[model samples]
Target: MSAYPSHPRATIGRYRNRGAYDFQAIHSVVNAAPVLHLSFIPSETDPFPTIIPLLGQMGSFANPDADPSSEPLDLYIHTHASTRLVKLVASQTEDGEKGLPVCASAALVDGYVLALTPFNHSCNYRSAVLHGYATPVTDEAERLYAMELITNGLIPERWGNSRVPPTKTELQTTGILKVTIESASGKVRAAGAANDKQDLENEGVIGKVWTGVVPLWQTLGEPVSNEHNRVPVPAYLDNWRKEANERGEEYAVETARKKY
Candidate 1:
């Protein structure tokens, strides 16, 4: 595990204070979800937050420096060349008086918690948040590679069956942005509420408030094809649906737990 810089208030018991910042951990979390909330406030004039759903990729690049242990970059997302978000990022200037965009990247890891402590508590989750500036990926080759990285991240074997390399027109119209993680924090809360020992003893088994954990998880579902379609179901889709059925009961239980 790569050592992440510690914050005084973030350290909690057995929550794994140090998580690997290397490519593996970053890629796993980024690829697990199809969409993430990308937040930004363009300037001081706008006090409210604008959140956008972003498709992303994560990987390591060979740092040109002579150092063998190159730094890992967190490549978050891209957009069409004409997107408003792309224009905002590209036109930004550091005039020393004008406002610069503030971008935040976030991902939710897992959900598992419900409790009845001093107050009736029913909250549980694992999540990570990153705050940084958005940098444009200017290199043509790098931008193309970033697109492939994102596509493969979403569907592991998708590129093999999809269209070949991008065309010149395609490349000309896409904008890729990389966000190097400056500071990030993750939180985990699980198990029943942490009431005082005396309070628990008093409540015993008579407390009216329900207290327990209901885990939440994402599950693949059966594939539905168009009625008029004649093509056979892909092998990968068929296998995924089969596995989901086998674990349907467990998935249901987890889903029910989350509702509480």
Candidate 2:
């Protein structure tokens, strides 16, 4: 069993329940998802909330020397230099009176859950929410690493395609923020709907209402070659097509259902 430092609010349904606090669970869900919604309160007098689409990079908590820590975990991300959200966060100083801007909440919802029974029915889900503050990456070397993390997060092979790395000038213009998850919580609900025995015995009731598990999954699709392109389809893409074929109509129908 893996352990993670927990915040007061992070404890499960009961402090005694002590839900799974493993870092891998948190990191996996965060990494699997491509986009995240970043929320922050602006420094200005406006009452509106600032929400931005963010690309995330996940890794163990490491210092400048790259020494990983078991107890503490850290993650990084980069965004446009001129983004209003970044500017607002950068303005806060570290005095007791004023500090770096804080993220009230950060969350990732992995899947939807559907509950069937009245008392025991519930949708299955996996989610994590973090309460913490954002720190700006000012050093040149760190900024480059942050960029690498962001690129690799989107696609693992992206770094291998380029022979040359980003120039210092390019790094300076980019804004990178490191969010140290101070306190976090993980929750999962994976149980079937609970219908009373009496309800199940009722005549014709079960037949009238559609009931059963509709398992959900995500899958890759066949790659359509560009009309102007002359090169053969890559082997990796061909493998995906083969896998899709093996899965057949069930997979196709599930993919179609998601579109709507």
Candidate 3:
């Protein structure tokens, strides 16, 4: 399969060696991230860009069962109808033109790298950037599909396991935006701190400086059921939490291994 053609603007500027355009690498980072930050020009008249932290996932309902590891994916963002973002996009986007130009980004910090020098300190991280055109979803079925996909992204098979279906009022108030990604890239840093050889040879500096990576990860806390609830925590939820924490913790520790 052809790789995503990199746009001039989408190209990585600094640390070019870290840039990646492989779909699997980019998609994996996006899917694994817990949060995504979406930014766009809400209006031609507004002074600053509008940015929002949104819950989103990347997939194509047209081919719902397609393997994400190989197929291209579109970002589906969940939002409320009343938000400024929705209102602006609704007003500005033309009928046929690529809806609204937008940028979406996600990142995971695996470890804190403390180097011998202040300037050398960095983090073990993985991140993805997508440049795309986002259009407000108008079709009813497509909207629901996006909703279910996003919910499952949060917790696998959560939609079917929850209260059967949403009410008309609930559906009315919610909005979903589907972003067709144009050009994208993923970037990563890892292994451990890379400090200067001169600093390592300096006995005083070596003795005085504490240089290493502090592994970091997101742990899923125990689920607390509401007072009205009677059921034991379902195996799905229980297992999801345990698996999530274990995966995160493992990556955090693995990224910190010294690369000698």
Candidate 4:
């Protein structure tokens, strides 16, 4: 599909020009983010919603080679089996519905935009929000697929380089939630500082205040080996780290030069 069907809850109200409903835009933001925040109501009487940070990935076990830009995908999150979210999903399944309702969001900041005034300051960022029904994965094969997908998503080829099949106890203790998306959208801002005409024309302000974008990107440090480890940093890890650093720096710098 080109894009997800629009829904009221998923629509962007302010700055609508930045909103993107295309599959590629939403999937790219979700997949590139290192962490996802999931929110849901804990109980009817709690009076507050619960939000938790989690590691998640978007993929399709049925179509392993599918193109994410053009094809639909499911979001998978792994956590301990005994967690409150997992238990709630299980109960929801028994009630004969799709599963527990949830909202997942991910964001990446590319640069800090500094303007003459505090009100004009902003950040260049990409963010995605998704509403879905999260259900526990009962199929062992699918669960294993999701585990490997998430592992490799973090570090390419890490799953194959490390342990093989997980033990029975490990399998039993790990919970995988597959989220079927209901509506999703992405918002992006990749631009330099936007200064008002008044601020730009004021000689005093223009001369005294420094206005520009401070490019920012996550950097991966050198791998610190365990005390008991004998192996050096593997070629795969070192190569991935170098490539990722280069990509991040280049993107941030390029984004900083864009006009708002």
Candidate 5:
């Protein structure tokens, strides 16, 4: 689907202009984020929902060749088989086919906007939230596909370079959660500080207070080898690190310069 249908739970109420329902917008933010926050009700008797940080990726195992920007995809999260979330999903799905309900979110702060007043200060960021059903993957082929996707998503080509196939115990202990998203939305703010007209007109305030955006991005540093390592940093990893740093800094700086 090109865009998710607008639902009350996923729609943005404030600053509606910043909200986007397109698949490209939502998927891009989620995939680029370093980690995702997953919120779910632990049990029927629990009054509060619990949130956990997890590494997740969005892709279609059935259609590996599909384009994420235009095609539908599933969210995959890897964890230990005995984790509470995995066990909970297993128990909930035992009676029926539907899995446990969950909400997943991802965010990236592009820059910090400093305004004259603290109330006016804001951040330039991209965020996405999704509502879905989560279930543990059972099929061996699909599980393998998701494992490879998750591993490579962290570091491209590392899966093949380090290992050929997982050991029996390793495979048995690893758990993969497949989330079929029902509703999703993305919101973004990519502009410099928005100062009030009165503040801008006052020389004392304008001259004294520095109002601008401080660009921020995650930088990949030089790779350090562990003890007993025999090989130098491979060309693939070195090249990826250099290019990623450059692209990240460029995007952050460009976003900081944008005017509201």
Candidate 6:
């Protein structure tokens, strides 16, 4: 197992020591995030970048069960066929998944650090950025694989719990973007506030300001079934909710530690 070699663009500049090139660390950050922000230029003539909130998972369909640390992985994004991004992808004629160049970013904010001074304030967080080339998947088998991968990634056994397979009409409207990840990196800030010694010594500032962390967490609400639905919530779903909340709780605890 090896880390993805750092690319010039993927290199972290600020807080350089915090940069993490480990594939597992980077992949876990991306997978744990609730939503991925996908950014890309719509066209060469377009001046502004287009950004969209997306749901994605990284894996190799050839060996989907393999640990992400072992080798290269691709990011699969589920989308609709008529989306603007999809239109641009279909318009492209490049080879080798030559659809569009994109950057995928994911982040988790554990807490806010209220420092003695505004300049010293920070947040406990984990973030990851991945650069890749995305192309619309045309293969039927790969499409199905991506669909199931996303479903199970968010909620284990969700695909089976729902309809076993999508209908032809459903598959026609659904689309997947396969991004071949070229470079990626993860950065994390878990320490507490780093207020300057001078600020700590200021009696006037200390008297008026309360400095500490307010922990934040992502929690799942109780499941609510639709009026027409009669099936009870599955055990796997309940377990997944507990696991997700526990992960958030662990990070909240991490942010509560004394500044390292």
Clash totals for all candidate models: 0, 9, 0, 0, 0, 0
Give the per-residue lDDT digits (tens) of candidate 5, residues 1-260. 59876799999999999998898998888888889999999978979999999998898988998887788789999889999999998987896968999999999998999999999899989999999999989899899899898878878888889876999888999999999999999999998889999999999999899999999999889999999899989998998898888988998899889888
lDDT by residue for model 3 (1-260), tens? 53466898878899898888888878888888889999998767879987899899988878988677778888999999888887766765665666788899999999999999999999889999999988888899889999999999889878999995899999999988888999998888877888899999999999999999999999888898899998999999989999999989888888799582
Q: Per TM-score, what order, best first?
A: 4, 5, 3, 6, 2, 1
Predicted structure with the largest lDDT when compared to the true one: 4
lDDT of 4 by residue, 57-162 (tens): 9999999898998988999998999999999999998999999999999999999999999999999999999999999998999999999999999899999999
- Which segments of candidate 3 are over 4 A away from where they belong? 258-260
* lDDT for position 129 in model 6: 94
Please give the distance, in angstroms, between residue 19's alpha carbon in candidate 3 and its true position after superposition: 1.0
Give per-residue CA lDDT, model 1, range 50-130, as digits (tens): 888878765534442312123445654867877777767766633332323444444543444445553555445434555
Candidate 2: residue 248 Cα off by (Å): 16
TM-score head-to-head 4 vs 5, winner: 4
Which TM-score value belongs to model 2? Answer: 0.71
Q: Kindly provide the TM-score of model 3 when superposed on the true structure, using C-alpha atoms.
A: 0.95
Which prediction has the highest TM-score against the true structure?
4
Q: Is candidate 1 or 3 superior in lDDT? A: 3
The lDDT of each candidate is 0.57, 0.57, 0.86, 0.93, 0.91, 0.85
lDDT (tens digit, per residue) of candidate 6 on 1-260? 56776898999999988788888878888878879999999878879998999898887788778788766678999899899988887777354446688999999889888898988888888899998888888899999999998888777788988877899999999979988887898888887778788888899988889988877889998999999988888899899999989988887877767675
Query: Measured by TM-score, how close is model 5 to the native structure?
Result: 0.97
- RMSD to native for every prediction? 5.7, 6.0, 1.5, 0.8, 1.0, 1.7
